[model samples]
Target: MMTNHICFIGGGNMAGSLISGLISNQYPTNKITVTDPDQQKLDQLKRQFSINTEIDNLKAVEASDVIVLAVKPQVLKVVCDNIKTATLKTKPLLISIAAGIRSTDIDRWLGGNNALVRCMPNTPALIQAGATGLFANTSTSDNQKNIADQILSSAGITLWVDNEAQLDAVTAVSGSGPAYFFLFLEAMQAAGKQLGLDESTAAKLAKQTALGAARMALEGDDDPTTLREKVTSKGGTTAAALASFENNNFNDIINQALTAARDRAIELADELGKD
Candidate 1:
């Protein structure tokens, strides 16, 4: 386990998930601290994780080597401002999990020239089954990057992009990816119900099918395309369904949706970065 004194700047669900992942990986409870405005939330985390809890953000920053910015994006600027002085004094590596915020904006907010890693993690992270895309600012060292990777990977798989712009694509793909799958599951469940299955049975079958398909995709040697081809016989039910999807331009629909999502992510960065 890493011995770095890690501090989480929020006590929300994501923060709790990270703390849980760290503890499950045997990271030292004594080396972890969480700071939040809500004493009750802090108290709950303290009881649950046995880690230190503080209401003073600066005090927590001063005591840590790594700071996880797990707060909402709208309040991140204020949180950064609140702890800027202590962050400068301690020079802790900042790992931000806030969505749609840029590294440049965060660096500027924190007095600049700070080592920071900005990552986009999906909601599945709450269950330790997430996919995260990370990008490090130029000031970040290789060791700091590795540390950030270790921290995020505790929740799920981590991938690094060569440039920050790719993070926008990552945001569209994985950050909002869970919702796309959930929507598909919803459609499948509804279709099953239309096919005469009861609501509960349809829901169960759809969810289990999704889980099994995901597991197979993750564990199988064949690529998704190959797997699909193998499962879909020519002129069969699966092929007919796929043909209907093609007829309706499913690939183009997905492309347009992701493009729109990426555009929105870029717009959000611009909107959130403004002083």
Candidate 2:
């Protein structure tokens, strides 16, 4: 068991995922602590996984060997400032999951650019199928990074980037990618309903299609575009549907949306820097 204590400053869904992953990986439960303002969430965390819990972020930071910041972007600085004031110079490896908050800002708020890892993990992590993008400051050691990879990979796949700037593109892609998929699923369900299927039936069919298609893409030899082409025969139903989407510039629309999301992510990062 790793002797280094792990602490999360929030007990929301993302934090819950990390905590669960840590416990499932047999990292010492006694060495992990989660802090959140909500007593019910804390209780759930404690009851579900036999781990230590706290309500005070400052206290949690003081007691950690690896501090995971899993709070919202808006309140990140507030939390970081409080942690800085309460924590000793003997710093822990700070890993943040707050989207759009840069490591430099975290280091600044924490008083210096010490061991810090900036990460963006999507909502899928809750189900242990997430893909996370991680980047670290110069102060982060290889051993610390290995530890981070272990903790993160427990939930899903993890990719580390050399340039933190690429994280904005990652935010546009995977970080917010799940919602895009859910939107497509929702539209499919709605279309099914319009085609006279009942709500539950429509939902089930849509979900199955989404899941099966994803599984096929994963298991199939062909690439996604090739597979799509395979299903879309000339003058077939899929072809007709794709033709309509093409007429509406579907690919361009998606590009525009992602570009907007990426710009917004960068803007948010800049805003966080200001605060």
Error of 2 at 21 (Å): 1.7
- Candidate maximizing TM-score: 1
Over 1-275, each residue of candidate 2 has an lDDT whose tens digit, in order, gives 45688888988889888778777877888898999889998999899989999988887777788988888989988887788865546579889898898999889888995799899899899999999999999999999998788778878899999999999999999999999999999999999999999999999999998899988998889899999988988989999999999999999999998999999999999988886
Q: List the residue pairs that clash in candidate 1.
A: none
State the lDDT of candidate 1 residue by residue for 196-272, as single tens digits.
99999999999998999899999989899998999999899999999999999999999999999999999999999
lDDT of 2: 0.88
Reference-based lDDT, each prediction: 0.94, 0.88
Cα error of candidate 2 at position 126, Å: 1.1
The worst-scoring run of ten residues by lDDT in candidate 2 lies at 81-90
